[model samples]
Target: MESRFLGIAELTDVPDVAVVVDVMRAYTVAAWAFARGAERVVLAESLEDALALKARRPDWLTLKDGPPAPGFDLVNSPALLRGTHLAGRTVVQKTTAGTVGALAVKDASLVLCASFVVAGATAGLLRERACERVTFVVTGGGGRAEEDLACAEYIARRAGGGAVDAGPYLRRADASRSAAELRQGVREGSTPEDVALCLEPDRFPFAMVAGAEDSLMVLRRVAPVDPPPSA
Candidate 1:
């Protein structure tokens, strides 16, 4: 089995398994949402699709950009959803990179979303499944956000059987262009706290798997299987 890291622009051929990483916010929010007991999180490819889904199902929470709107219950902020009760509830999210990258890999046999929260388990799952070709897609904030690239590298390291301390990488991400902009907008909506929260590595033990549910890409939690004890 071979694994390769590719940015969105280089996604020419789909692999047997595709892992999309958007550590700055998107996948981190999903991890936190599930940790908070959300029934399931749906990944919307665009704002329009999220709104359209919300229009049809008023019970689902729609989270997007620019602070929580009056009618919207959430945004792409992990800190924002940390205290919210998501039990028995579904969240529909549309983000700039994560969801788009996830939906773009339509040809992969399996699709998973990765972040620092699930890095170890994600790697374990990949090796367990033994896929021949695995691709990690780094969905940068613009062309190649610094944070996402760092995250992609970190995930790749863990997947390739290496130890990773997220501290240094997280610090690098905090200094990235995306993190700087998010900090600059703290008063407007984006917060440094959210950026801080998303950088914590292996915070959760479960990996997020994405699949089509009706017209939405729904994410479900998958616990990585433990290996047999060494002889």
Candidate 2:
């Protein structure tokens, strides 16, 4: 059976599985931090809460920060994550879209953190695992942005799924035509090269497991022990 969509607004609807994205920065930085050897990354919806968590667990090696989308701390930009050495540490990150949406849908049977950084590989992993349904929570900067939607489209397409339509949840959400958004992302220093990089689709097959003593969720490539039948 093929996978299908629920609704964007139904992010917290408790589906079989869901992937929360903050690829521009929150999720992106999480990936970079893990790649830099950080032990794990914790995604928080609030700066104060993340800070408090870090304070409570200083030994966990937590670094509290996230994207700034107005009142937020950091913006979701790949440029920010570059050259950061989080090796053997943990991070407490707060993002406007990715974090909020993720928290909203925290009740899912399986919640996977994703973005362009791990999109393709994530698709394969989900397919292999055979999740009955998968939802993409776009975290639209208090709504939903075109960049996130486009990224979602690519992921949904890659998964060889989309039996359910999510347009209803996106009715009030803002989106740009893929071409225009891509161009703007490039002109704004986001860079077409970065887009290409994120488009690698699951370059990292890492999954974040919550509730572990490891406060930080690092990207660890997952090897499917039971290989699926090749098409």
Candidate 3:
């Protein structure tokens, strides 16, 4: 069977072994955070809210984060996580889009995170594992989008053992309009390019696990099956 199709906006859906796509940035940012040696991350939609969480935590908590721009230390760029630059840093990043989406799915079943970088891993995890169902939730601008929904459809197709279909989402399952309507108004920035990296299959081994906090998720770095070429 196809398991089931769910589209919730929060992490409580993790039990469904949900696939959360912040294709615009949050999911992408989470990818960069883990790539940069961030042991953990507290996702926040608003910078004000993210900083407030940091205020309560002790100094032992190393922190780093930023905007969606490339110059910022924590912009949603996976390229930013390259080399030995972030050997021992734990980040607490804030993005206008992806973080907010993560905040929305705080109660999901497994809360596996994705971007262009970990797409293959996401699909493999979904297919090889046994679960009740899987939800494909994309945050920012309802649900329809150029990249997010395309990303979602790509994933859903992979999980369901269907053919690889890269066409845009449609209004009706049979409509000509490409792409779902929920992905409208997605944020525009370097986030898209970052998303491209997330689209690549099995490039890295990292997944986001939601913590008890409202806007935070634990980033666990999985052991690489093969040597990553000079990331």
Question: What CA root-mean-square deviation does each model show from the true structure?
Answer: 3.0, 6.5, 6.9
Top model number, lDDT: 1
**Full-model lDDT for every candidate:** 0.79, 0.54, 0.51
Candidate 1 lDDT: 0.79
Candidate 1 deviant stretches above 4 angstroms:
186-188, 227-231
Which segments of model 2 are wrong by more than 4 Å? 1-12, 59-77, 141-143, 161-231
Instruction: Tell me which of candidates 1 and 2 scores higher on TM-score.
Output: 1
The digit string of per-residue lDDT tens for model 3 on 40-148 reads 6665556665556556753313223343432233444554454435555556666655555555666766666665456655665665565447666665455554465
**How many pairs of residues collide in each model?**
0, 18, 34
For candidate 2, the TM-score is 0.67
lDDT of 2 by residue, 38-152 (tens): 7766766566766667668764433333223333333344555556666777666665566666666666666777666666555666767776567777755444465566556
Ranking by TM-score: 1, 2, 3
- Candidates in order, TM-scores: namely 0.90, 0.67, 0.65
Candidate 3 lDDT: 0.51
Comparing candidate 1 with candidate 2, which one achieves the higher lDDT? 1
